[model samples]
Target: MDALITEAKNGDKEAFVRLIRMNKQSLYKTAWIYLRDEQDIADALQNTILSCYENIQRLREPKYFKTWLMRILINECKDILRQKNHAAELDDFAEGVHCEELNLCEWKQLLLCLDKESRKIVELYYFDEFSVKEISALLEMNSNTVSTKLSRARAKLKKVIRR
Candidate 1:
């Protein structure tokens, strides 16, 4: 992989393509975490590939290629997420859905039963599918504490659903 990165940094197009192929699965999975639509995912992946190809020469550590690639992909995915949010807001406005007529989903109501902090934790863990370490780092909590909170949150949700 390091050799491939080296070749890519030297402007070898084939090596760049091979490197992108090697990280395709990881790139897709990371993009999926932030965007639901297939078009959005493809957009993010395409942008990531383009950005990596252009910047591969600037990467300082060949061994850290995957990490570098993932960081770029995450940034691209977040950009798409923000754009989607804005578009969806405009869409909802155009559709003229009344707030009063909107039904609260059981899942949303269940999440509301939790405290704000716990609600965020639950959303990051389940909805975003972030692992314990990822959530902990994002939330600045210890991994064990994140695990404990997730367990407690699950128990609370189950208890509520039983009613």
Candidate 2:
């Protein structure tokens, strides 16, 4: 893995492709969980890959490639969300397709009730199927903090769902 990363950093396209191929699923899943929209997930994954390729030279530790990639992915997602929020002020709905249904409405309402960080914790832990440790590392947070966030998020979700 270290050799592959070194080759990738040295402008080996094949090595870079291999690295992306190996982590594609995880990357896509992470994006999906965060964005909650297929197009957003796709865009975020592409951005992350491009950023990784462009900035591979900045990676000092080869063993931390996964962590670094995840950080980039998370940052991309956050940027997207920020842009979406800004656009929402001028538009009715941020670019996502919506269907008419009571359940869907309820789900959207439930999601809307969550604070951003809590929503992120819930999405990463439950929707992405990430372990608490993984979530902590990916979010650059302590495991105990992740656990607390998850608990609070779940409790909030339950309250919203019950109402």
Query: In order, how many clashes per candidate?
Result: 0, 0
How would you encode candidate 1's per-residue C-alpha lDDT over 118-151 as one tens digit per residue? Answer: 7656765654456787666655679999899889
- Candidate 2's TM-score reads 0.64
- Candidate 2 local lDDT, residue 92: 14
Candidate achieving the largest lDDT: 2
The per-model lDDT (C-alpha) reads 0.70, 0.77
User: Highest TM-score, which number?
Assistant: 2
Model 1 reaches what TM-score against the true structure? Answer: 0.57
